[model samples]
Target: MPGEQQNTSELTVEELLHDAAVDSTDIEVFLNALTRLAVHNLSHPGEELLCGITLLRQKKASTVASSSDRAQKLDEIQYDYADGPCLKAAREQVLVHVPDLQEDARWPEYRETVLEEGVRSILGVPIAIGSGNAAGLNLYSDEKGRFDEEAVESAQQYARQASRALSLAVRLARHRDTEADLQAALESRTTVALAIGIIMGQNRCSHEEAFDLLKSASSSRNIKLRELAADLVASADPSSAGAHFDR
Candidate 1:
């Protein structure tokens, strides 16, 4: 009904995701907003549709976002069994439709479980994120044959429009993660260097000797190098109570 009343097409996927990302603090929150928008725009009058997004990166599958708790649970059921329509669609980069779960013989165990959840119809559309990543847009409905040919086409088209935005989001998330990792590495290196300097001052040893001493202490104590370095720095400089590598 919402899709019928308004021109949902007026809002491009890129714009939708951009708004979501701007309002969200992280990728997970942005993805959650994306699923909610998909459900709102795709559901018809009196037709309760549940939506979920499954992301597979480096061969690991995870339910990244869902429209509701029920949708999240349904996606988890598929992950628990490690075989379901969404996984199939994502892995093969294709659309999978189950008009009637009771009649669909594929994934018998999953079918039984989803049927118990009152989901009679399902649709899974692949989302092309990147080479090492795969994703799927999963839709569930209580009425059998809810996703007819027309509905299937709409879902497919939505997936195509959203895939580019999803890819960009994933890349931005990776970039953020890389930046955080690099910052952490730099902080850790700085702390360790400070610790080495302290060791050299205390023992009047060379830089290499101080490093060897720190390494030996870390090995003997069975503590992480960074943690030991942080502790040493903290002890030497009481003013620096909380070192960068404390975390």
Candidate 2:
């Protein structure tokens, strides 16, 4: 209803991307929406285009989202060979365009496989999201020369416009991950403390002595300290063994 009066084509790139980010509930959902948007907005009329997004974080590249299953499979082929236009664009932060895969000689093995998949032209545009992280927008077309100069420029511009929303999504995901990690740490500490308290009650020993006993048992059993603590707590009181935090 928000765009009922105005056609989607009339929407500015910023508005489109902002709507995508706001509509999504998580990073994965937003990326999927972005790939779908790319295929819809960037593709020429009557031209079939498959879009995929490759994200590079901490020097690792992964296909984060795709407009279709075929696009996802195409992106995975690049990962299998460890060299492809998308990966190259993301790593070098440059655009890589293969107007005709058959004529391209850069990635011999990669080109062969991609050609077999019926992709004739490929365009990879790097998304500039600052902070040591990189991403690339990959477009696959069955028609050779599908991504001509004008099309390439359009794709590049789309990537530039999409970067801001993507950066915010990545930051939100990282924050969620950090919070989850902290919660897990607190739960583990609580479990260990409860286990130590049980040990103290059973042996009538000091807190340090109880902790040493727990550590010695954990080492002897070749089990992690956390696991050992969990087991001890469970054995002592099944109902109260579950990790509980005040927050």
Candidate 3:
């Protein structure tokens, strides 16, 4: 109803929550959906909205999704130059409104590049996830002064919507990453256990002594317990792993 959004504003919280639950397994898919939904709800004729979201990871920023290549290209320009409205919005946790790229002296290098590419205006609104991860939703236009007071005011509403969905997606991604790390730790512990068992059987040593031997070998060889265990397991023959451990 707002632009060409199919009345996304009318979507009940329950409905949004239900859809989010369905996408809990894939945060990228969920984040992309949120960007598309925001663009659809806020786009206008002269504005010709092309939207993208930049995600900050490990002190680096990358454009994760975009409604069009136009937005993606602009994101790259900002990233390559390492300074732009979008970066400020994400890093400073403030809204950055660039009325005209040609006249904006805030980021001289970025301004010249986008201005050459026919970009007239930009609005970067920070998407706060509340988890110390910075992100920004960027909207670009080809017409100067497209994002006036009323326009920005309306866009703020969509920014909040995108932020909510993206925040949940971020949490989902973190949960998935945490689960993977735990699984890896469990697997590594299991490998060490198996290695210890092999050492006990081969060396006729107590369980504690076997573990100590494994630790000694790990430290001596400058290898991880998992790597050493894998090597031992690889060298196992039908005869005995005793010879392997002796090495």
Candidate 4:
């Protein structure tokens, strides 16, 4: 099985990106699919394959995705103890391999807990995505010595593929978030403008005076200008404002 050349479909760089794009902003979906595909294509000798993508930001590491619930629980155990191969790989940006957790000496508590959970082998591959962010792909197996040199090498390649796709997904997710924020800002401005129109028509005031009056009202009520405008807009149009912006 080690030297067998299976003619599986080669995962191209473009295909990974396409998968990431298809998942939209769901990091869990993208990572779970990527890791499962990686394990299936590599044809490793293992009963089960599990993966977790960790995002390191603000000096904090969190498991963002996993291929299975067992994998997620194992990762959580490591996080609880602050010592495990996955957390180490993510925090230190290194490749971590444990051939047999029962005999491993690196993490005493973690090794004991994982062995009880029927996890015998693990591989952690660092995934760097875009700027100011890094993640790790964690693989778990039920068989001991499952992740040998060849498996590790194959996992590295998959991690590279995942990195490319995850980088794009991260950027796209940020873009979507930014776009949403800008849309909300613009909508708030429009609502305020509409409220200003109402104020001008009712109080016979100029544009500047109307805005000042709105601000004064907002300050007096201890509410945001946008919130005051939204309220005013809701009062002006009983149907549109609540239907569109209340969310």
| Winning candidate number (TM-score) | 1
List model 3 lDDT by residue over 92-195, tens digit each: 88999999888877888788888888889999988786777878888898888988998798677666666666777777788889999999999888888888
Candidate 4 local Cα displacement, residue 95, angstroms: 0.7
> Sorted on TM-score, highest at the top, how do the candidates line up?
1, 4, 2, 3
Q: Which stretches of candidate 4 lie over 4 Å from their true place?
A: 1-8, 12-17, 22-25, 43-46, 237-247
Off by over 4 Å in 2: 1-26, 238-247
Better of 1 and 3 by TM-score: 1
* Model 1 whole-model lDDT (C-alpha atoms): 0.87
TM-score of each: 0.89, 0.84, 0.83, 0.85
lDDT of 4 by residue, 1-247 (tens): 5234331333454485567656667656766676566656655455567766777766677777776677678778888897788878877889999998888898897788888888898888888775788888888888899888988987887777677788887777778889999999899999999988877766777898888888888888799998988887777753333222210
What RMSD does each model have against the real structure?
A: 4.5, 5.4, 3.4, 4.8
Clash pairs, model 1 backbone: none
TM accuracy, model 2: 0.84
lDDT on C-alpha atoms for all candidate structures: 0.87, 0.87, 0.79, 0.76
What is residue 16's positional error in candidate 1, in angstroms?
Answer: 1.6
For candidate 2, write residues 174-247 as lDDT tens digits: 88889999999999999999998888777778899889888888888799999989987877854453432111
**Lowest-lDDT window of 10 residues in candidate 2?**
238-247
Comparing 3 with 4 on lDDT, the higher-scoring candidate is 3
